[model samples]
Target: MEKEDLKLLQQKVTKLRAEGKYKETIEACYHLLKSGKECNDFKSILTAHINHAASYYCIGDTEEAFNSIEAYVEVCSRFGDEADLLHQYNVLFLLYEYNKDFAKAKATLENCIGLGKKLEKYNIVSNGYSNISHVLMEEGNYGAALEAGQKGLEASKLHKPASPILELRVKLNIAKAYLELNHFHASKALINEMIHDPILESFIREKSQCYHLQGSWYRKQKIFKEAFDSLTVAKELVESYRDLYLLKSIQEERCQLCEQMEDVQLGYRVQKEYISLLNEINKQELALTALKLEIKHSMSDFKRKANTDFLTGIFNRSYLETTSKEWLEQASVKDENIVCILFDIDNFKIINDQYGHLFGDEVIKQVSNACSKTMKENELFARYGGDEFVVLVRGASLESGKKRAEEMRGIIGNVKIEMGGNSVSITSSMGVTDNLDGKVRSFQELFHHADLGLYEAKKSGKNNVCVKLADKE
Candidate 1:
């Protein structure tokens, strides 16, 4: 293949892997390897091997993944890019960590950091420090993790354009280290700082880490309710992002929480769920190997269904929770505003009781459609629950959020669903909040305030929009 063609093909493999089509990605990589070999394209061939290894790892084929990585290393040793070598070493670190080879993982990360500094790739150096911290933490060396985390933070600051995500990640690792060391006050202070950080909100994986650490801190303090809530949010985020590795840790924490609460049945149920989730993840990974060899099933539908709500044909709560954080983070960095609007159908239960669920479903569909129509560009509308819907307006001011909420309320209130030769109209109550200034408030805090406003709206009268501002703290 030509050079441009080879580049496009490489991108295709990457895209496929990113989309979670591991089988398809592996197949593409195989084809690329064959083509590269025929064309004597050593670069393409080496890249194919690396891509194949990543895809294999994703599907739980550890042996093949390791073999491919080895092959990639050999190629890099002969004629590889310095940056590519750095990346491969990082990947090797993960592989070693997965196999419980903490010593090797730590060494590999150190090598990565050295190479990155030599090459002036400060980002890589920063990331290497972060990875080392994580490995050390896994090895039950909190002091070392804290040391590495601080180094990572300092290294990250050396870059021309600071990476908020990386900075937050290092801080979170340090916070975890603090928590593990039983430095409760120190950890709590750091956690509070990050929880309200707009920059941290963008990175869901790191945000989840923050929450997990917060849960740990709360648990240590004997604050059971706060601990459970934080852990639950962490669980939700990991599940949404499909971070199986992190999910396992969260599950273990939850099991502990259940035990501490003395809820044997709940503990049993949590343990069962953990097992089921693990099995499901393993099954999917194994299936990818089968798919590469035998089946060619498409996963697009499965992905769509996972992120979509069946009833309203809109984004589900999981999608909202995951994506909205990213949007908020971006808006924060740009010094723009993000408006969150929470609304639900008024007297939805009564409608269901009187008109039956079928009619109630129609009402929901109609209201959802109306609300969706009122959304502007870059806005997200999601079915929060049975009758609750949330609209996220990116780059919008507090006033704009309230205006949008009123517009949506009008749209929903005017919506009429024809049911059994009867015209039934329903109204909606809405709450709006925005992050305009630098005043820090977490997504949970924003949501809580909006919910309170919604309650106030409902109390005064339904079919109205209420505005709430973030407290100046």
Candidate 2:
């Protein structure tokens, strides 16, 4: 693709991903990757993988998102792109934290800070310290968390254009640390200032956190009425966004609502109501937990009807249309190397005429079985009409994807159906491509490019595998 073509694809995919269409975003990234003349050795590969990984992260595929990020890191490492490395290291730090690898998370953040210092990128340094505070907080080192957050704020002052979001994050971390250390006055000062800040209007979650912390401080000071007011606002704010975690925390605090009140009778009445509400909350939480467990088991049942093909009992065209982009996004989410493998039976029309429709049905079913045997457990495989099949392989690069396609072709060819006193052989032409290029907007477009490779495979004779990385033009 030309520079203008790549830019156009980027803009289109950006719009799609911004619209929360992660599947489309992943496909776009596949095109982006294809546009780069040499993704395994190119600078633009960074943007391609970043966009690709973010989509994967958004779609609950952390593994693939991280894989995408790892590739981004690998390319950056090769080019000595420290600035990009510094930022992506934060991403790696968070990934480690998400996986409860606090030791590695802290180390990654330290590395980020080191790169920031080397590059003199104060904003990166500030964010790195702020992240260190998060790890420290997780490790129950409140004093250290507070110190790191203060360092973050100090570094922020030097980062030009100023990041209010970063500043607010550091302050929130500091306030929490102070409260944990029983520095009531210090925590209160930060909370009071932030609670009324105009910036909080655009950051409701931060505002809610402020109110919740304020309520906790007031409650500790034996000021129940003020605590109640703050807690109520916090509850409203958290519930507005349906933030279950914050809501639950607020609810837990709200349960002791009437403590330290002068009016004993009124306090008792309010306490009783809160106790009842708490009881209801506990029951609801129990029900919610049970429902989640049940859904985990029944999810496949829900998907099978709409997604499965009746003939081969594999995924249908509809499934591919609905899920390719989603699978792409999911692949990108985990920073996973995602490969789209497109293939079709060689001389299928001739086979249909020679062996008749019944034999063709048998061939299709057997081919589907061969595909199932070739691919991994959770790979997305679907019949793309007639004899064409599409497999969205997550955690695989173009190289691995070709291997898988070849395996499938070989397996399908080895199968012979003896019918009408004759035996039949099957072969496949395949095309494989990756989404790391950061080009294209949907899986369809991504698949179409892979199809170009398939067309080449056909030209190279029946059973051939071809890959499309970037346009030779």
Candidate 3:
């Protein structure tokens, strides 16, 4: 087939799949595969195999789905990119999970995490950890699930511009784990934190989960009225969203709540509703299964793109500013040290004038890479503006912050990018400040102090570091 024809066929298959026409998608993929094979087009064949698997899975043809996925994986191993491999692992994990093959699902998630870390795909890493937590939770290993949930949250922070939904998911998992462990205070604290987040109102599924968990928390405390109200809201949300799986879970919870309240009539009514919902879900499972898989895949991509900076692959100014305030509040409550560092490329305009914008872009990438290499797990680095960057270090003292800033300066200074026939060197000046007096500094105050330190560094020399302490009063 010609390139344009092949492109058109691919688009047709995609559209059919999105429209829930699984049978038609399968037929189109097979035809495309056959045509491409006649012309020895391995790339097109690989694409067909992947789509074929997804279509088969949606239609409940597990045997054929497995065969298609096997072929897809084999081709991916030979010619696919990291993203391709990540997708394959996710599909495999979901397949195993649906089949109740917990061991295989866990193993696949672990492998996915390894590859995600190797490629610096922090979003994939976070998903892998979250999936692992889910599996552990299902297996009734609350302790392990709690640990995995925490790890997932940590990995999520490594992603640029950190996704709010992803963070909420991890926190919900942790709260569930805590509930199982009878840590009511901890679980309640986490749930209450998200209950009023305006963002939750838009995410129907997440909001349902939040209310469900809140219901569970109330049940544990024997607050029957509150539990009933929360669970009712959760059920309504799930029904409105048409989330059959979550709806089933919510109905079961309602039945349990009714039984605990000694409302036999209500319990019986809920039980019947639950059974009816389960039967309907099973009837439509094949069709909904495929749609769910596609939604999961698209959501991951959407969240990553929404939270990522296209140029530097690091956090942007908005993310830094918003997240830093939350971190500051938490640190203040705990009386822990929180440090901020502001820095910018020294003589950046001269470099741009001498080397052109393209070369200047290369310099920015190289410098960002160098700084990223020096970052600790708890530190956040972001591109504040054209040439300036900011770093937030939690649990760091004034002296330690200064030391880290100096180390970053040294690493950035030694970075050399080869341009044409010349080796161009880059250096940065840094200003460091810390809030250690148990005072909660506003974002503006923190930035102002850090900027003052940067000014002192620039005054002393172009490539140096300076530290400014918070006001003692």
Index of the highest-TM-score prediction: 1
Off by over 4 Å in 2: 13-19, 37-44, 162-165, 240-242, 256-473
lDDT of 1 by residue, 1-473 (tens): 68889888889988998898877787788778767866878788887888878877766667878998998898888888887888689779868987899888888988899999998888888888988998888888899899999999999898768777767778888888888998888889999999889986677877888888889899989987789889999999888788787888888888888988998998899899899988987887677568655522333454477679999999998788878777766666777778889999999999999989988888888888877776678798889899998888777778878988888887777888887788888888999887655243356767877898899899988889888777866
> What would the per-residue lDDT of candidate 3 be over residues 116-235, giving only the tens digit for each residue?
999988888888888898999999999999999999999888888768887888888988999999999899999999888888988988898899999989988999879989999999
Model 2, range 208-310, lDDT digits (tens) per residue? 8889888988888888889988988998998787666567667667656654455667667656655665676677668655644453344345457557898
> Would you estimate the TM-scores of all the predictions?
0.58, 0.56, 0.57
RMSD of 2: 11.9
- The CA lDDT of each predicted structure is 0.83, 0.78, 0.85
Mind sharing the TM-score for model 2?
A: 0.56
Ranking by TM-score: 1, 3, 2
- Model 3: CA > 4 A from native: 268-272, 275-279, 282-473
- Evaluated at residue 184, the lDDT of candidate 1 is 83
Worst 10 residues of 3 by lDDT: 298-307
Q: Comparing candidate 1 with candidate 2, which one achieves the higher TM-score?
A: 1
